[model samples]
Target: MSTLSLRGIVRQFGPLRVIHGIDLDIAQGEFVVFVGPSGCGKSTLLRIIAGLDQPNGGQITIDGRDVTGTRAAERGLAMVFQSYALYPHMTVRQNLAFGLENQRMAKEEVARRVAEAARMLQIEHLLARKPGQLSGGQRQRVAIGRTVTREPGIFLFDEPLSNLDAELRVQMRVELTALHKRLQATMIYVTHDQTEAMTMADRIVVLRAGRIEQQGSPLELYNRPANKFVAGFIGSPRMNFLDGQAVGGRSVAFEGLPNLDIPAARETTEGEAVTLGVRPEHLAFTDGAGLPGTVDIVEQMGGESYIYVTLANEARLTVRRPGQTQLHAGEPVRVAIDGAAHLFGRGDDEHAITPRRLP
Candidate 1:
């Protein structure tokens, strides 16, 4: 089994501490993604796990064995980096066999792995060609094939699709997902794109600065974010936030909207400052009791439209509706928070004081 565990992991570069007492456990054969913005130490943490970088403290273990002092080559892991680090002069077959040769593995076995990896990645036709002769996607497949031949216990991917174009990235994502299931290997991926993390990961570890803010399934984080950072980061188009005061028992008082009796899973003390969160799809134009705003922009995205509004308090809020929209800029409208609403303590790192956590 390829289970991984990191306990009280800490890292520093001279006097500057980057990772701070991190603790995480990854199950065998699970696809775990580490996601955060740049400088968030995702790549640094991945390197530490891969044994490319040593942590200042804590222990790293694989399958119950303490591997904190193990060499990267002996740790039984292979990493695919952001750049397709293929040797320019080597053919696909040679590149795939190079690592095996360095390990003094049998030539026949090397040939078998190279052939199998090429076949699995559908790059058999490009096996004889050098890296210069392959397309970007083909090159990436070759890069991954190089790792597949290693047959490592865990597959570590550090933004493996970042170099590809948008369409190619989507294609690679599908390929990688299929490959993971085919091998049933434990995979740890690092990316800044939350959409990528959402679509590919069995578990997502949301990191900010250097610490993990929250870790859960894609829907768990989307529906019940632990804090404001996660609430804004996990969803597409992002969740909108408004400043408000908790009042009238389980209700909120905010500018633009009247005191709303929004149900929060957790009860907050009355008069406590809180923030109201609403996703674009949960909001709509209403004729009844609602917040007044003027339409600022209506973007028709084929079968769906995203309507941007300027509230009376000048806070911008987006409402997403299905199909075409008749709304236009400068049109006065009243928007209703129709769907589930979330409440968070004021500021970025507070937990969901409102909305239901997974049952």
Candidate 2:
């Protein structure tokens, strides 16, 4: 296992800077995930860590040793790419042993490592098959097995499961999580999929346009996003935002709903613009007066349902219900914002204004 650190990590493509002074510390045996939208520099940062790309500035440290100038091969790290990158002609066993052989390791030692990796990955039976002869999931296992054979201090994965179908991706996610637990190796993963970050990471770093937006545990980011961007990016179906005006002190009046008093840390002047954020699950259906809307769509997902409604002011909101609902399209519905509502100041820099409440 290894502890990795990055200080003032900067990357530039000619005149255009992509990574701007990133600073992070990853503990030994920690599974940290970098997540963001496309062109957010998550993959670029991963490449810098893997020594595949050098940073324009800043230092990379591994196990308390500076390795910014070290070659990738000397970094004692293994990376699995989105593409399997396995040699089509080479069998799984050969692929797993190729690196060791190139390093001129003893034949017995190389064989022992290959055997152990194959066994750990449950790909022993497929060791004799070439990449073309195996399924996508099987090929992925071989690729991971190849990395495992190296027994590196850290493992890096760059959207390794993006090539698989949804079901296979989920299966591989569980497999990778179990592998991490079994090996207790430091792993850093990069992906645009928030689900992957939420499910697998001990800590998640959310990047945006070459800058760190937020870095925290999944629930921390979900329940208490620092700003509107992090709040909108971290959750599935995303948090709903509605325009409102601060009536006074802790009272805010929604555009099409009654005024409600929420816990706000800062005092707001009367008639100040603010955005109200409420997750789908945080909005409850109420029989009495509330935010009036017309149900536009309903998505039934086995045990739960999502009610999509258009409010009087044309703002759309999705309400997540625990069970199947009889609510249908064109039906009138009223939703009351629970105490879990988040309040953010409206502007270019939309920071959260609501006090953090216990979940």
Candidate 3:
């Protein structure tokens, strides 16, 4: 386990600045995940940490050592790439032993490490098989085992599960989480998958436009997003944002719905535009008047259903309902926003209109 810190990290390609000046601190043995959409610099940041890509500026320290210029090999970090970069000619045992051999470890010690890693990954029986003979899941485990035998101070994963099937991805995610707990190694994983980040990370770092939009525990980010972008980004099915205007203090009227309660502190200069942010799961199909809409789509998932409603103003909202509601397309539906639903200053997209101070 080791701590990592990045100070004023910057990465640029010619005049195109991809990673803005960023600073972050990662605790020893912490499982941190970097997640964002495509071209968001999550992978670039991970590469910088692994010493694969040199930052245009800033300092990177690992375990109290300023390893900013250290070679990837000397950084004492092992990286698991998305491609499962196993040698085609080598057996699983050989692949696991390769790194130890490069370091001139004794044959007996190398064998011992390989055996231990295989057992840890529950793939001891697959040792004699080549990469071609292994399934995708097995291959991924081998890739991870290859890193494990190195006994690296830090482990870096770069979308290592992107290549697997959906079911396999979920299964591998569980295995990886368990492995992290057992090893208690400092892990920094980069992925575009929110489900992966939400489920696996002790802390999730949300990135956008080369900046750290927000960083927090999964639930914290989910329940109390810092801004509109985060509110929409963190949740499954996404949060719905509708055009609204603060009519007066502590009240905001939706364009096509009744006035909903706003935090008293929400700045409401006459006709000040704002966006009302409500999450699908936080909303309920109510009997009383709420946001009136027509059900546009219904997705049934056995025990639950997702009702996608399109408001008269053209804004779409998704609501999670219990079991299968006899909802069909064009059915009249009303979704009551949880009073605590977020409101944000429309143009700036940062100001949270909800009560800044919680009771």
lDDT of 3 at 296: 95
Each prediction's TM-score against the native? Answer: 0.96, 0.96, 0.96
Better of 2 and 3 by lDDT: 2
lDDT score for residue 343 of model 1: 89
The total of clashing pairs for model 3 equals 0
Q: Model 1 over residues 1-56: C-alpha lDDT tens digits?
A: 39999999999999998899899999999999999999999999999999999999
Worst 10 residues of 2 by lDDT: 259-268
Q: Write down the lDDT that model 2 would get.
A: 0.90
In model 3, pairs of residues that clash are: none
lDDT of 2 by residue, 1-359 (tens): 99999999999999999999999999999999999999999999999999999999999999999999799999999999899899988989999999999899999999999999998889999988999999999989998998999999999999999999999999999999999999999999999999999999999999999999899999999988988888999889889998789885767787657776666724677888988888998887899867888999999997999999998878999999888999999999888876477888898879888545523
Model 3 misplaced stretches (Cα beyond 4 Å) = 355-359
Lowest summed lDDT window (length 10), candidate 1: 350-359
lDDT against the true structure, per candidate, is 0.90, 0.90, 0.88
